[model samples]
Target: MYYIAHRLFAAHDRALGALIARQLAKKAGPESVFLPFCDTDEEDLVAPVKGHRLFELDRERLQTLTGMIAVLHGPSLDDGVCMEIGYAAALNVPVVVVTTDFQTYSADEHSPHWAFPDPLIETIAHRVTRVDRLGAPQLADSPDRFTAFAARNQAQIETAAAMSVEAILELAANNCPAPAPARAEAGTVFLEPSPHIRCPEALLDTLHAAHRSVTIAIRHQAPDPFTAAHADWTTALRAEVLVADVSGPETPPGGAVLIGAAAALRRRIAAHLPTAVITHAHGREPNWRNLMIQYAVGTRVCDAHSLARWLAS
Candidate 1:
């Protein structure tokens, strides 16, 4: 099966998604192409899905996918699509990233990093397809023009989908990366906590007892500049173990990305490096945590004590 990750929060996005899905299904089979907007449970249509449940549902579908074709649209890559790409890559599942946007938005052309579509994401992907001049057809003047514009530009949309589908089929046929050699245990434990953690020192003090070689990267200490942020993420992926604290009512966006990347790395390498996701004891409800992080890490919430125990064991 193939999963198409794209933005569907807008009317144009939904219409384009349907068009792409239809074309992909024609070539890959109706049952093979899974578009989140079209294939979701019926109840999701009637009401808003609880955050955790949505994450759980997507991750479950991801596990069964043979390859993923992620639409990297807009000036910046969508955070959720990045998570899906990272997660799928970690599982050694082949990924093909398709972007119709031709405008350049790089920090520096000479630099090894891309300011858009994200360098790490591109690095992990098996194939990157750029359909020049066939940019998104949904950039109509108004919302009402979306349908008419799509209808008029059907040829361009089909061309883009056809190119993406070609890449997906080719990659799926022969591009699965082999898992790294398994290790008994990972060397270092990397901790990513939200800036909102209460009594941070006490929490670290407790965890330090179980593991001495722990690296902590919180939002404040790590500069938000792209280069520094990229460096921190690269360092985190090198560690054999990852522990992310996602306590509180919502998962901090930055912390959630790190959790997703680390979890994918752990899975890609098999049982070599394990990832642990912990939340504050106060917010132990399953819905409090992002389902992608929870299911990908595959662990129960670890308070300081339990986290330390997990680190030691």
Candidate 2:
């Protein structure tokens, strides 16, 4: 049994959710049973008169699921979806989290922070698939925003749906084993600091002395330093290694400054430079920024001192 977990609180969400579920079901083969939360009529599970019963039914459904695909979007994880993911994890059901939004939120005076999908879900997901939000304009006054949005982004949406079905099939075939975690590589590291925070001078001196060519891409948010020395050091230089510092902005939205910068840098220097991201150690849950950076750069490191030591060695 394949389970589709997503938000259907709004009509727009439900429309898109139904389309995704349909595509998955069509591709998942006839023998595969699809249990989308939105299909209350087909699944014989309606929104309960009492909220507790809804969870009870959901738990029952999760136990019977062999594989699951979840849609993750917006700024945070929906509370109900988070609970469902936990349930699936406890049941050892393989889960694929499909992130449908990649565009950064427009920053304004009222909201300086970036919107990111919840790190917890990003961590727990057995596999993560991203669909770049093709340049679909937000239509505030459209009578059916979801339909309009789907029309505009049909190609990308279908691509994501295909990938979701493939992941579901793979999970079912594998009997729901957790995917192996990515291993971090050791090399000359590219250290990217969060917006506004400068790389420590001691770190820079050590990097220079260690024979590693380092390029520091300053955040657009920070005031450009005036000195020639600063200019020389901050200029983007090509190297065999790229290390991003993902320490700042506690909650950066999708397309966080470092993530965007690293992605651009990767594209520009990918033929020569392999990239790595350095982040502060948090709990085991993967940071959304870290995940994005990992997607851009092939390597990631959590311990700054350890990475520096490795560079020195």
Candidate 3:
């Protein structure tokens, strides 16, 4: 079976995503294709399930999936879809990213290459099927318009889905080995230090107190130091375990990308590289807007004391 990961918040996402999944199922078999939002009841808005529960459900499904067809739509890549790609890639499952975004955004401002979303995502994909959506009309709130939008993009959707199916099959047929594990000291943890992190010294001190070796992988922002940030992100991905302070006044650019990488690393269940996210508990909830981060890591601690306790256990 294959998992279909896409943004589900909007009418356009739902309409286009359903069309793609239906078309994909015709080629891959009806039983071979799964869309979490459509197939599962756990995400129902009425009496909604916890984010982690949904994460667990999806992770379980993904573990058994032969490949993943991820819809990489919009100007910015969807955080949740990116996490799924990382997780699937870590498991050595072939992933095909299908995008219809026509806007131009560069991975590096200084470089000549122009692209939407991040290379941290696209670089790892087995294949990226990019369809042109310039002719499709904007989605309206009405159901008829939504249908019209899907109809107009039917050829593009079918083409992308067909390419994705072929890519998945081609990649799955190859027997490529997973990269060798990084040479990390036992009990070593990679710390993704962010400017949004509070009491960074205390986090370091906590690691030192536990007698665990640490590697600080910093993701630089702005003026887009793409190469440097990518190197550090790879460092974080290869570490034994990852610990990041996701406490947010606001999510820094590229912050979610680091978390997504860590999420992927954590899915290496055989390697046991657990990832921890540290965020302040606001009233009862963590003070973060992004549920993708919570879904990615699942372990969120409020302070160094809590972190130390977690590490100790």
Compared with the true structure, the alpha-carbon lDDT of candidate 2 equals: 0.50
* Model 2 spans with C-alpha error above 4 angstroms: 29-31, 34-38, 42-49, 103-116, 135-150, 176-313
Best by TM-score: 3
Q: Rank the candidates by lDDT, best first.
A: 3, 1, 2
Q: Count residue pairs with overlapping backbones in model 2.
A: 7
lDDT of 3 by residue, 1-313 (tens): 8888887667778776787678778876889888876776534533234554556677778777688888876665566676677667656678888887776566355653434445456556778888766345645553686676666677677677677777776776683765643343457677755543443577789888988777765433434445555666566666666676544343332445556555655521111112334444222234244455566664566667877777776
lDDT per residue as tens, model 2, 198-303: 5456656666776766655433333322232133222422233445444443322211322333333342211111133343322223333333233444434445
By summed lDDT, which 10 consecutive residues of candidate 2 come out lowest?
A: 267-276
- What's each prediction's TM-score? 0.63, 0.46, 0.70
Model 3 weakest 10-residue run by lDDT: 267-276
Every model's Cα RMSD, please? 7.5, 14.6, 6.5
Off by over 4 Å in 1: 42-49, 108-117, 134-156, 180-187, 191-210, 214-258, 264-313
> What is model 2's C-alpha RMSD?
14.6
Top-lDDT structure, candidate number: 3
Q: Point out the higher-scoring one by lDDT: 1 or 2.
A: 1
